[model samples]
Target: MGIKIVPRHGKSLKDKLYLPAIAGGMKTTFTHFVKNLKDTSNLKTMSYPEVQPEDLSERYRGVHRLTKWDDGSEKCVACYMCATACPANCIFIDAEERFDGVAEKRPKQFKIDLLECVYCGYCVEACPCDAIRMDTGIFSFTGSSREEFVVDKEYLMSNERSKDLNDG
Candidate 1:
């Protein structure tokens, strides 16, 4: 096959100097600065932790949470689908057969390393039973040690309070 070469577009003297691009950038910056100065409340910046932003979208995925069944039991069937789909492999599951036989299996130990997680939402999509979701809206998390970031099954199951935050 022959190589097809595309012709390069020629630039004028003004275009080669890039003065117009610089002026356009300066104009945009000055306009925003003047607008923010005139009405500070219109500024997009927010003083976080104390005064959270009110412009979070509906589809904003935050922290992970384990869903519950009608009987208040965990909805996860311990199928390992979530761990398999996770690109970061942050999810850890230790499955055990259920005694009640309501489900074939249940996670004896489930943990997710927040530090290693990329927040890609693959686990949520891979779940067959609708047991996992990233809709808690608890994005702002702080910890002094790495151990704190490793969320266990109990933490994920009892994360209802996190969703109540208006800031998130």
Candidate 2:
């Protein structure tokens, strides 16, 4: 196949100097600055703690949480599908056979290292049983130590936002 080359458009002396481009950018900046200065209410700035915007989209993926069934039992079957699909390999799971027969297998231990997790939502998408989801709507957290960021099964289950995951 022959290579096809596109021709460049003609440019005047002023365009070559880049003065018009710079003036255009400065004009846009000055327009916005003057508009914001004239009307404080028109600015998009937020007071953060006091004035939080409630317009978050429903599809916003925030934090990961484990789902529960109707009978109060965990929905996960410990299939390792999430762990296997994680690109960052941040998820860890230890499966054990359930004696109660409610579930064929259950996670004896489940942990996720937040520091290593990329928050790609692959784990939630790979879960076959809808056992895991990233709908907590929580994006910020603090920890005293590295180990504290590693969330365990109990922490994931009882997190403040976990209860609201199924509401919508």
Candidate 3:
């Protein structure tokens, strides 16, 4: 069998010229602009810095944080589960044997590259010891340098959970 030649239909002058499509888009934009001008509240945007969201959802995945036990001991077992589960491969852990009875293995160093992290909760879910969590409710983070965004163990451990978010 030979290749079949399909008949092609020529586009209409209206289709050839994208002016109508552009005009429709412009019209929609103008309508929304006029509506927003009349009612500023209708726009789905918050006046950031001046106003913050009242509350974030319970499952809102924000920055990552390493949890601690009641005695102020780290909860991480240094199993590398978080690192393994991280899709972005942002988590890096160096394990050290812990002589203290608190846990078998503790992280000598744990670093998470916030810039590389996709804000996915896989790391939190992968931790069997309930060590890591992304519930700090800190969606906005700033840094002058790339190193500032790569948080170390101390930084992750020091990050406190937002009071506005549910502790549980």
Candidate 4:
């Protein structure tokens, strides 16, 4: 079927419809482009670490981070709340004992395969003890191999912003 549209404004019928629309679209695009150009000079973009850092509220859940106590120890009770609530089921946790607290069923080896992570942030919400969080703001990962995408405990906890993957 052929598309039909009514003319809005112009001297000619064609000009009234097509020309005005084209002009209007061009004007909007030009306005946006100019705004972006000006913003580039100012720290308009979120550079994360270099420029502006993320102001994550309690609501923001980027990726699961095990919480720390005032004494600088893990807060994860390993209740598996996050794992159970995780829609993606990317969280793989193995709990162990710290002998510090009754809830101290800490993950002996906690892992999250980024390959399967949908970034839904559900895991963070499900954490009752606030043990797991996704607010490190270290939101960058890249790899050349399948195994590299699977984020091990070392990579997740090392506080490193991952870049290029290793070659096999």
Q: Which portions of model 1 show Cα errors greater than 4 Å?
A: 1-45, 161-168
C-alpha root-mean-square deviation, each candidate: 5.4, 4.6, 3.7, 9.8
TM-scores of all models? Answer: 0.70, 0.66, 0.77, 0.55
- Ranking under lDDT, best-scoring first? 3, 1, 2, 4
Q: Count clashing residue pairs in model 1.
A: 0
Name the better of 3 and 4 by TM-score: 3
Model 2 gets an lDDT of 0.85
> Residue-wise lDDT of candidate 1 within 4-35, one digit each (tens)?
99976547888888898899999999998898
Instruction: Please give, for residues 64-130, the per-residue lDDT of candidate 4 as tens digits.
Output: 4566667766667778887898788888888887787646477787788887888888887788887
**lDDT values for all models:** 0.88, 0.85, 0.89, 0.69
> How well does model 3 score by local distance difference test?
0.89
Which candidate would rank higher by TM-score, 1 or 4?
Answer: 1
Off by over 4 Å in 3: 1-10, 38-44, 166-168
User: Of 3 and 4, which scores higher on lDDT?
Assistant: 3
Q: How far does residue 120 in candidate 4 sit from its true spot (Å)?
A: 0.9
107 in model 3: Cα distance from truth in Å?
1.4
Better of 1 and 3 by TM-score: 3
For model 3, how does the per-residue alpha-carbon lDDT over 3-103 read when each residue is reduced to its tens digit? 99997654888877888889999999999889889998767887886687767678788888999999887999999998999999999999999998988
- Could you tally the backbone clashes for each prediction? 0, 0, 0, 2
